[model samples]
Every structure is written in structure tokens, then in C-alpha cells.
Target: MPAQVICIGSVLWDIVGRTPRNMALSNDVPGRILRLPGGVALNIAQALAKYDLSPVALTAIGQDTEGDDLMKASADLGLDMQFVHRPDDLPTDCYMAIEGANGLIAAIADAHSLEAAGDAILAPLTDGRLGSETSPFSGVIALDGNLTLALLQEIAQNPLFSNADLRIAPASPGKAERLRPFLTHSRGTLYVNLEEAGILVDRLFDSSQDAVRALLDAGAARVMVTHGGRDATFGTPDLITSQTPPKVNVTRITGAGDTFMAAHIAAEIQGASPSDALNAALAAAASYVSGDTILS
Candidate 1:
């Protein structure tokens, strides 16, 4: 089937170590480690697939054995991988994170291969395979901040994305500023946490409501801000909606934001109102963090 959505950015393995006890600096604890197919774009794509949306993942994967395994794993999740750029030079990227009961202690993202691949992965979008300059892709597009600043800037202004419904997210707080270019995109909706929103605006926000309103005032077309287990708000210039996520034990913190974004997108596409969509997203995210949703 043709693609209903396009997920662009890092696509690789996620090695996460989760421990039940709270941890602090220089502390090592016994935990379970799982290597899963992840990355902001891939996570969102996987969630979209579960919603019956055919998503095409556009990113770089090396020709190494890890890349081969990752491709097979992603295909098994119902993602369209035919348009991915597979170069023989770079090795598949990976992200490692240590999550304790308190939260994410530290993480390292080895996405150099994706950064080096750059705009090459987007060739299919402009080469008539999915779309061209004259006939651009008008479907829903999920983008992540794992890309270099230059490429993200180009996409913010590129006509190829002008007609698409863009949903942008930062891969992590460290990469949050990379999404600055799309702050004013007419059709873009940013999914960010309270800290990530503060990074983009350069000011600390007290709550999701404050952050969402501040982002709208700062020229963002639309935005969704989540403040951990507090509350999440979705806002536009004229209207704003808020939803408090159901409280649950957060056993894992890795893909919660991506799940929220994907669930919101799916709800909106199914003609849900903005308020209902926010609720649905928060519910899905709560399930993910509570370890109630199984990852394939």
C-alpha cells in the first residue's frame, strides 16, 4: 500500500537499561537490558502502524549486520522501508539510556550516521517516488530533531514540506533547540516536554499551560506541551485544550512522548476534536510509561 504518513529521522536500535530502584550520580544498579527497534521517528511509525496507518520511514541505515537486522525488525512492525537510504560506509546508529525509578539518569545517542547521511535520505520525497517539487507530499509527516540543524532548517522552509501536515519532536532535551526553525511553520505541530519547550523558548515555564501559551505567542502555528505526570496541553492561537494523564507507575520512560504524538495524530486523522485527541494521546502515553503496552 502507498504511504499514508512519512516518518523522518533516526532509525536504529535502542538499548535501554531499566532498574526498579532510584539512582543517582556514579551509581550502578542491577537492571534489565533490552535491545529494541526505536528512535523518535521509528517509534512514532510503529505506533501509527498499530493504528492502521501505513507509514513510510525515511532515514539512513548502514549495510552492516545490525542494519540488516533492524530493517527486518522494522518491516515486521508494518513500516514501509523501501525508501530508506542504505549506504555501505556508515554503520547503523544506536541509542543507549539508563532509566531508574526516578527517571532517565543519562543517555547517549550515536546518530552520527544519520547526521552524515543528511538530506540524501529525503531524495525519494523529491524524486517522484513519493512526491516531487510540483506534486509535493500532502500527507502527515512526523519529523524528529535527530537530524542536523542545517537539514532541519531546510525542511522548515522547503516547499516539499509546505503542503504536508507536519508533526515535529525533539529526540531529547539536548537536541530540542534544533526544532527552532519550525517554530513558525504554518502547518507544523510541535510535540515537546516542559523542559524541551523551555529550551526552545529560552525561558523556564512553570506548567504545560504556560508553555503552550508562550509557544503560541512566539509564532508557533500549533504545539503540544507535556509536563511529566502533571498535565498536557494542546494549543493554537485561538483555542487551547488540556488533559491530565491517568496516573500509573512509570516503569519505563523511553518512548512515551513518541507514543503521545502518534496517538494524537491518529486521533486527529480519525476526526476527533482537539480536546479528545489530547486525552487520547495522554492515555496512550500513560499506558506506555506504565508498561501496559507491549512493544513488538
Candidate 2:
């Protein structure tokens, strides 16, 4: 099947340790540790694949055992891996996180391989394989801030992406500022949490609504702000809509935001109304956090 969208950025393994009880510094409790295929782009692509969107991965992976496993896993999940760049010298990247009852305690992302690969990872887009400047890709492009700031800025101004529907995510709160270039790009739509919005706008927002308004005022053409279990809002200069996620016991936290973003994109692509898309995204995220299987 042809690719419906392109997911760009980190593609790696996630090693997560989760404890049902609250934890603090230097405390080690009995918990389950699992390794899963993850990363912002992969997470979003996996979610889209669940909806039969057939997203193509445009990122870097090492030519190692882990990278081979990730490719097989992505293919098994129905993602297109033809565009993934695998360099023999680089080791596969990974993210390690410790999540406790209170929430995420600490995390480390070893995405040096991706950073080193740089624009080489985007060769498919530039070398007339997937797209070119003269005939820019017109499909949706989901981008993550795991990319270096230089690459992100280049994409923001590059002609190759000028005609694409750009959906941007910061990957995490720490990387939110990397999305600054897209704030003024007309084709870009930002997906961020309240904290990320605050980072982008340089101010604290009391709610998602305020964050949406602030982002719009700050030159974001389109924006979506999610506030964990609180209300999430999608907005533009002319219109804004909000929805509260269904209440549920939180069982997992990783990949929830990516799930929401993917669901919203899939909903919009399927011709859902603004309200319907927002509601669907919230419900999907709630289901994911509540430990419901997202894909059949």
C-alpha cells in the first residue's frame, strides 16, 4: 500500500521501568521493566498504522541487531520502513525512563545516532525518492523535535516541505523550544502539552484554552494543547475547540501524547468534524493511558 503520511525523527527502543507506587531519589522498588519499539515518530506512526493510515517512516536507525528488530517490528505493525536510513557505524539509539505512581521520575534519551545521521536521514525526501522541491510531497508530514535544531529549521523553510501539511511535535518539554521555527510557518500545526506551550510562549498558562490562545497570539497558525487528564484544546486564529478526556485510572504514560496526535490526524484525514476529531483524540488517549489495547 502507498504511504498516506510521513513520520520523521527518532526511531528506537524504549526501556521503561514502571512502579505502581510513588518513588523518590535513590529508591528502588519492585517494578516491571520492558523494552518496546518507541520514539516520537514511531509512536505516532504506530498509532496511525492502527487506523490503517499506512504511515512511512523517515528517520535514522543503526545497522545493528536492535535496529533490525525495530524494522521487523515496524513492518509487522503495518508501517512502511522503506525510507528508514540505517548506517552501519552508528549504534541503535534507545530511551530509558522510570515511571512511578506520581508520574515520570527520570528519563534519558540516547539518540546520538539520530543526531549524527543528520540530513542523511532525509535523503529519501531530497534525492527524488519520496519527494523533491519542484514536486513537494503534499501528504501529511508528522515531525518530531528529536531532529536536530538545524534540521528542524531547514524543514521549516525548505521548499520540499512547502506544500505538505505539517504536524509538529516537540518530543518532550525539554525540546519544546526547538519548534520555534514552525510557530510562524503557515503550513505548520503544533501539538504540545501545556508545559510545552508555556515554553514556546515564554509564559505560564493556567489552562489549555489559555495556552491555545497564547500560541495563536504568538504567531502559531494552528495549535493543539493537551493538559494530561484536564481539557485539551485545538485552535486557530479564527476558531478554538476544547474537549475533556474521559476519566480513567492511569496505567501507562509513555506514548499517550503521540497517540492523541495521531488519532487527531487520522480523524481529520477521514473527514471528521473539528469537534469529532478532538473528542476522538481524547478518547483514544484515555483508552491508551487506561491500558486498553489501541490496535487489534
Per-residue lDDT of 178-284 in model 1, one digit per residue for the tens?
A: 99888855559999999999999899998999999888888889999999999899999999998889999989999888999999999999999999999999889
What does the lDDT come to for candidate 2? 0.91
- Cα lDDT over the full model 1: 0.93
Model 2: per-residue Cα lDDT at residue 3:
46
The candidate scoring highest on lDDT is 1
Give one clash count per candidate, in the order shown. 0, 0
C-alpha root-mean-square deviation, each candidate: 1.2, 1.3
Q: How close is candidate 1 to the true structure, as a TM-score?
A: 0.97
- lDDT per residue (tens digit) for residues 1-296 in model 2: 54489999988999999999999999989999999999999999999988888899988898889999999987888788998999999999999999988888999888899999999988888778888867788899999999999989999989889889999999999999999988766559999999999999899989999999999888898999999999999998889999899999987888899999999999999999888999999999999988898732
